[model samples]
Target: MTASVLDCISLSYQPLWGKARSLTGLALFVQPLAEPPVPGPIDARALLETIGETLPADGPPLFVVPQSKALLLDTLAAVEPPPAPGAPGPRFATRGAATPTVVVPSFLLQDDSLVATGVRLGRDRGLKLVWQGSADAPPADDIRDGFHRYWLDLPPPWAAAALKDATRKAAVGQQIGPGRLPPGHIYGGIESRVLMEYCLDRCKALALAGWPGEDVVYSLRHQAMQPSHAVVMATLKAVESDRSAETVERILSEDPLLVYRFLVYANSPALGLRNPIESVRHGMMMLGIETIRTWLGQQVPYASREPALRPVNAQLVLRARLMDRLLDAGIEEALRREVSLCGLFSGLDLLLNEPLGVLLPRLRLSRRVQDATIMRTGPYGPSLEVALALESSDPSGVQALCAAHEMEPGRVNRALLDVLSEVDPDGPTI
Candidate 1:
């Protein structure tokens, strides 16, 4: 698609959390240029194709929830599943590998036209239909059997109170009756940790549709963030093969905690280095490839085995990469790399368990990086802010941020898509 199409739309992703807080997939939200730009009701098939190109072949399943009937039909028709493994074709095409899931709101099932023939088409095409509804409403019996899984919304506060005030009210804890919300349906719109836990732990919900932003888990800030052993091993491999410092540094960026630890180790008095090692590239150079390899080896066992944290680090890395991309191409590579770090460490306080004001000082990072991460100022600050706004899929917020900085929204969009499109998952392509 042309750049104009991309400019007319904005994309935001919400991670889906499954068992053990593992990231199961992403909910791709597409907003068609509204003023403030909340994810719009219906997205075009072109938008899906555009997004599909960016996702890795092996990335987690993607769920698209369309808010309009025509759009839903068009969306389903736009993609064809991969012709089995050995079929005649490229291994993976964006449309074929889009994998067949379209989250249909419960209300949509009421359409007489849909139940009549649409259900048949879904089955014929190998589509996986998922039902989305609230605690008080569900699909009618006629269309209920078509969906593979259901996405149920918890009872609203008023509804719970109303149910409690009824003559034959649901007793405490029975407000979400199986009759309305069958067990095993994924919980949708999980905005907080409490809701996420109740659905995954207390209720029998199979998975969650959205993450409770990290702010909700502020208490976990002090808990040590774990680095994926897989990533650590990758860094070690790169170093052992005598890859350029840039290559090793890119691998290190995949896991911020590992990068932090590396910087800390490089700065240790044991090294007796004359200079500070603030960035991963700098650390690799000062510490030497052999020293880095030995250190990474020692870290393999200490790495985290939890499946959940992989996406956490991946998302952070993407933001940093986007920040770097948003800068003018003419800018020197060193400044660009430094700005990327500003985005990378922006949230280190949460992972590192100390305020950046205090934590960043110990690392002795450059003033610009510190200012952007801590004070949210400096030349790097605008790009970081824009990157964050883009995450929300609020086109207006992104536009405003760009305008304020005299940056172009088109460039921001290009930068974001470029970073996201290039994602290479740690696991095999699905």
Candidate 2:
């Protein structure tokens, strides 16, 4: 059989942070799901090619592939680069022109012969080697001279906290001298445990600090204010029309703050504008009605008087974009719009301190959108579940939702990666 097993595999990337919290590398893991129905030895070349196709062309050069023995022996062994100039080697070009530095598990060094062969082949093909240590495979002194770099794998449960500690240690290590311990030395099991405990304490503190409690929600709603209902209605209406210059201008006139924010966003570095937007009419023409619609929709929920809600607002925008991308190519245009709305409104109860049953009616959303957001049972509900699953880092939940909706994990991951870039092109994707 052809290597259809490769289709079942998915890549999950974890970002490695440096001293300044900058992206130093990416750790790629092949999520070990249930075996494909037509199981045999997976075609290593095909699996690598499939993964290569899914990765962004401009991603980081350092890749930490999984340390599975099968992958080490079959996959890495088979990944050969193009032949050197006027010399004999593999004819086919792998993935792309960039030869990534592959970080394998330290256990591979246990077999000295394998290490020698793999290192020689990797060097010849321009692939540098780094060694990663895990709980099961600790670093060995024998392999110390084989690789130039070393990384420790953080256990999944404490990964976030460990990464934070590691970043802090790295930052401090940069400023200290000979007596000080470096980041590498501080990122071991004991440090991770301490960081994890600290993280738990911080989480408890945040929980008690009025984040999602009803009191906090109520306080936020009482203090927060949104744009005028008339302006909102007019803007929504303008979005449906062919030429809305007059409507848009009137709305801008009513709310100068809206005008200022719109101009700022339009002219922001993210949009890469050559000339400044001079008027609402200019913005309308340049950004188009749909872009303006989405922007306006985002502003309504996010324009809170309380500064604490800023992060919440950002999260709402992220959810909307994520849902939009996830539903791409899968639903009708109108349904896609509704799905985006559902995502935006999913947090309405928390944002407004009112039940969605009471709050959604005010927005005059469609019955299906209301059902999906409030009850979580409708055509759009499954997509929302998938989005939430991803947000919560629940892989099993995400897989179940994806399977129920006939969505491919690879496509979902690709969609998520694209949305992440769109949301924060310059920020690290973690």
Instruction: Count the clashes in each prediction.
Output: 2, 0
Residue-by-residue lDDT tens digits, candidate 2, 205-270: 111100222333455454654533334555666666654577565444333234445666776677
RMSD of each: 6.6, 11.6
Candidate 1 lDDT, 271-299, residue by residue in tens: 89998886777777677777877888899
Scanning candidate 2 in windows of ten residues, the lowest lDDT window is 203-212
Q: Show where candidate 2 strays beyond 4 Å.
A: 1-6, 15-27, 54-56, 60-64, 79-97, 101-126, 129-137, 144-148, 153-322, 328-330, 341-376, 387-401, 404-406, 409-424, 427-430
* Candidate 2: pairs in clash: none
lDDT of 2 at 19: 31
lDDT of each: 0.66, 0.52
What candidate 1 gets wrong by more than 4 Å, as runs, is: 1-3, 20-23, 35-43, 66-96, 104-127, 131-133, 139-148, 155-184, 189-206, 212-226, 241-244, 297-302, 306-308, 393-410, 425-430
Top candidate by TM-score? 1
TM-scores of the candidates in the order shown: 0.73, 0.51
